[model samples]
Target: MLIDTHCHLDFPDFAAERDDIVARAHAAGVKQMITISTRVRKFPEILAIAEKYPTVFCSVGTHPHNADEELDIPVSELIELARHPRVVAIGEAGLDYFYDNAPREAQAIGLRNHIAAARETGLPLVIHSRSADEDMAAILTEETGKGAFPFLLHCFSSGPELARVGVELGGYVSFSGILTFPKSEELREIARTVPLERMLVETDAPYLAPKPFRGKRNEPAYVAHTAAVLAETVGVSAEEIARITTENAFRIFSKMPRV
Candidate 1:
């Protein structure tokens, strides 16, 4: 079974047919999914979704885009929320220089706090980094020096250097539907270099749908397409890729119960 390690099931895009969406994922062999958190304030809603679906899990913490809005959220609060049985990870949080939706300093501060929470709780931090590889790499390295923490560079589309830094820091790398794009040869090459054991696949729906599904609303079901491309990129069979990524998912999101 494949695990969609990162997705936003609480988003309105899935509200109309949420049940159908989950059913499709199951039919597609996506046995599990972690609906990531973008705002600590809305965690109750996210948690509600997880509670509704037996196969779904959740995370707690703010996204970098909304970091400034939740600056008052302490690491202790994140730790407390993560104590929930359904909350399996922390923070779709990190630097997002591409949008600059939140102040860079605020994003950095929020990331550090989330990292601390992950370190303390032994949960994986679902990091969302974009157009800030240098800063991302520096912060990850600096934080690891403070002490190790489990993390996944979610929806990675960064340069090879950042990928190398993430792997070297013992962080897992999750590829999104972007991996199936025709012009993503560079990303595929990076995937080739990453150890299969440290790799994961996600859809980040409702966005970045893979290949034939591109421009359509994405869902957990489409993670299989990315997994197929990752298999080709890494010289493995599709079944092998699914097995490896599912294993990697449970390894990183250790709080998630096995099926």
Candidate 2:
């Protein structure tokens, strides 16, 4: 079985046929999925999706792109919200200099808040970093030094230094469909070196669809394709790759039941 450790089922892209999407996922051997929240304000929408499907779970955190708007959200509130049975992790949060849609300082402050929430609640932080590796690595390293917190560099396409630092800090690194692209040789190289136990597979769906599906809308069902490529990159059987990643998912999102 496979678990899509990260996805965005709440997005409008899936609105027209959400139930069918989940059905297809289960049919594709994706036993479970986590629908990530990009903003706490819409958490009810995210939660509704998880609540509607027994195999689906969710996280609540502000994406860096909306960090400035959510800066006022309290860490205490994040901790409180995470108390729910289906809330398994925190943040799709981190730096995103590639877009610069939000100020860098605001993004940093927001990331720290999510980190604090993760540290306090023992939930893995779902990090997103792009074009801001140095600051991202430095902040993650610094915050982790204060006290360890479980986290994953979700949909990772960062510099090797940041990947190295995250792994060194006992954090996980997830690969998305981007790894399957012909031009992602460098990313595949990094994937080869990331310890098998710390690796995870995600689609970051409604975004980076895998090879044959590239340029089209992505969904949880497509994660199987990413897993297949990950298996090749990791030098293991497709079944072994699925087993390892699903195991890693349970280890990090300990709140989720093993069934």
Candidate 3:
């Protein structure tokens, strides 16, 4: 069995066939999926999806891109909302200098708030970082020094330095369909060196479909393709990759019921 630890089922791309998308994922051997949140105000929509499906779980926090829009969202509110049974993580939050969708200062402040919620609730932080490695590394290092919090670099596409820092702090790295792209050889190399115990896999769907499905709509079903290449890169069997990532997922998202 495979677990797609991160995805966005609430995105309109799946609006027409949301149930079918999730059904196909189960048919393809993905037994569990976590529909991640990007905006705190969308928690009801995210929660409704999770409540409607037994295998789907969710997270609650603002994406770095929308940080400015949700700056008033209190850490206390995030912690409170996370009390829902199906809400399993604290964020799809972090810095994204590549887009600069939100002010850099707001992004940093939002990231820190989400980190605080994760630390307080004991739920893992689901993070996204791009083109902001220097500040990301410094912040994670500073945050780790203040107090340890569980986290994973979701859809990881960063430098070796940040990857190493994440592992050093006992956090995990989740690879997506991007790993199957030919230009991602460097990323595969990083995957090779990352300890298996600290690795996870996701599709980040409604985007990043792997080879054959590349440029098409992605869903949890295609996590198999990413997992296959990840197995090849890490010198492990496909079944072993399945076992390891699933084990790691359960470890961090401990709120999920054992299957």
Q: Give per-residue CA lDDT, model 2, range 151-209, as digits (tens).
A: 99999998788889999999999999999999999999999889999999998999999
Off by over 4 Å in 1: none
Report, for every candidate in turn, its global Cα lDDT versus the true structure. 0.95, 0.95, 0.95
- In order, how many clashes per candidate? 0, 0, 0
- The residue pairs found clashing in candidate 2 are none
- Indicate the TM-score of model 3: 0.99
lDDT of 2: 0.95
Query: What are the models' TM-scores?
Result: 0.99, 0.99, 0.99
lDDT of 3 at 160: 93
Clashes of 1: 0
Instruction: Supply the global lDDT for candidate 3.
Output: 0.95
| lDDT (10s digit) by residue, model 3, range 133-203 | 99998999999899999999999999999999999998999999999999999999999879999999999
The regions of model 3 sitting more than 4 angstroms off are none
